[model samples]
Target: MKQYELNTIPDEGYRQALASLLYQLADDDFILAYRGSEWLGLAPHIEEDVAFSSINQDTMGHASMIYELLASLGEGTEDELAHGRPPEERRNAIILEEVNGPGDYLIEPRYDWAFAVVRHYFYTVAKKVRMDSLKQSSYGPLAEAAVKINTELYYHLLHWQTWFTQLMNAGGEAKQRMEDAVSRVCDDFLGVLTLGPDGESMSRYGLIEEEAILASRWTEALKKPFDSTGVQHPPVIRSLRGDGRKGEHTGDLTDALHTLSEVYRLEASGTW
Candidate 1:
């Protein structure tokens, strides 16, 4: 029931909580999208390559939307927030910040397709869960942004869900690889579900559903596929690496930021 617009938020504490949440949302999508793009020519097939590229584009656009909302609240311009921040200042979940697989994209690049599919599928589902709750967020701009972003999620979810389920059902090496990837993803999955220290105020302010509620919803959503696929249900997700909401990150994020900001830093401003 509590609702607020861009500049109409009731207090600085609320703004801080809102900013923290927005940064998490924006940073998660931004980095994940970049990882998706790395699969540009490396996907299983040409059609899928195109489809994945489009999905990453949409995901990056969603990040831009939230970054703009943050800028409206005096955080910084969208580009600056996307490109200027150091790794420790980022708020994305550690799992989402993880690289697709070993080897550089342009080098020998021994990437793991199973890991890429698993990671994207899990992250996309989490994004959907949050977007559903955010549609009724206390902040007006954020709620509206959620409404806009939610429309594209159906296709995103379907795409990943299909990939996840099909691979799990295939059996043999495909199934084994997916199982390994699932375990790896589950290890740090809690990073995706947590709301960090500001969680209490964020929930109390009605910005979005509480972290536990949203986490429960995400677990429930995955039940259908996990049940049908025969993969052992990972009941409890934990963050073995670190909690990214608190700005704790691995070297993967540091390297990612370097690559992500290289072009932006070269051309800091628009020119004719």
Candidate 2:
């Protein structure tokens, strides 16, 4: 059987654990992509808006694949799984849900491009590390999915890293803005790194690599370019807000969920 091939019912404990990991992956990408979609047509520039949308689409596509995996496991229909779930049930990090800035997407957004770049770039790198680890996961289907997902991430990582490097080296108001944005993103980065309460079990089962190892690798991967450009890397990253893997979230997620699921919610019980 193909590595990415669907399984009817996983009788083994490893398969069940794999399913849970996949759910977390799907949920995280779904929520974050929804936030990214909100930024559409509202970015600082036209070029950036186009580039940003591509990344959002890629993320949503990844989420869709995960949802399909869940569907195969009889979790629920993909549409229902995505749109019908309440905020408290969401598993995305609080940082992914945070508002772009002080205003609605339809209004004068007053969004911060610096924050967007920092958050997306950092998240992309962190995700790359995680995905690389997953490519070697014990679960065959997930390992295959990781290999496939990692293919598109090359562009996503480059796109954000370019923005991060350029802005940090811009040497003016841009640098100050980016610096401030970095501080804000780091405050909640741990939320993205956490693998929930079952992290140890996941690692023990070889479902995914150790979180600390992944986090350190992420730090190292980001540090080289940052050091070359003289951008200061934070001594340590902490989730000052809270952990999202534990189902803790923020108001931003509440608003974003409403927007993304609006049409879906209109006919929650009906097929769209």
Which candidate ranks first by lDDT, i.e. highest? 1
Model 1, residue 41: distance off in Å is 0.6
* Candidate 2 C-alpha lDDT tens digits along 51-142: 88998999999998888877777788989788878878777878888878656644665678899888889889988998999988766777
Best by TM-score: 1
TM-score of 1: 0.96
Stretches off by above 4 angstroms in model 1 are: 103-108
Model 2, runs deviating above 4 Å: 1-16, 102-108, 269-272
Which pairs of residues collide in model 1? none
lDDT of each: 0.90, 0.81
Worst 10-residue lDDT window, candidate 1: 102-111
Query: TM-score per candidate, in order?
Result: 0.96, 0.90
Residues 1-272, candidate 1: write the lDDT tens digits.
96888768899999999999999999999999998898899899999999999999999999999999998988888889999899999999998877788666446556788998889999888999999999999999999999999999899999999999999999999999999988888899999999999999999999989999999888889999999997667455889987899999988889899998888889978420
Question: In model 2, what lDDT does residue 218 have?
Answer: 89
Q: Output the worst ten-in-a-row residue range by lDDT, candidate 2.
A: 1-10
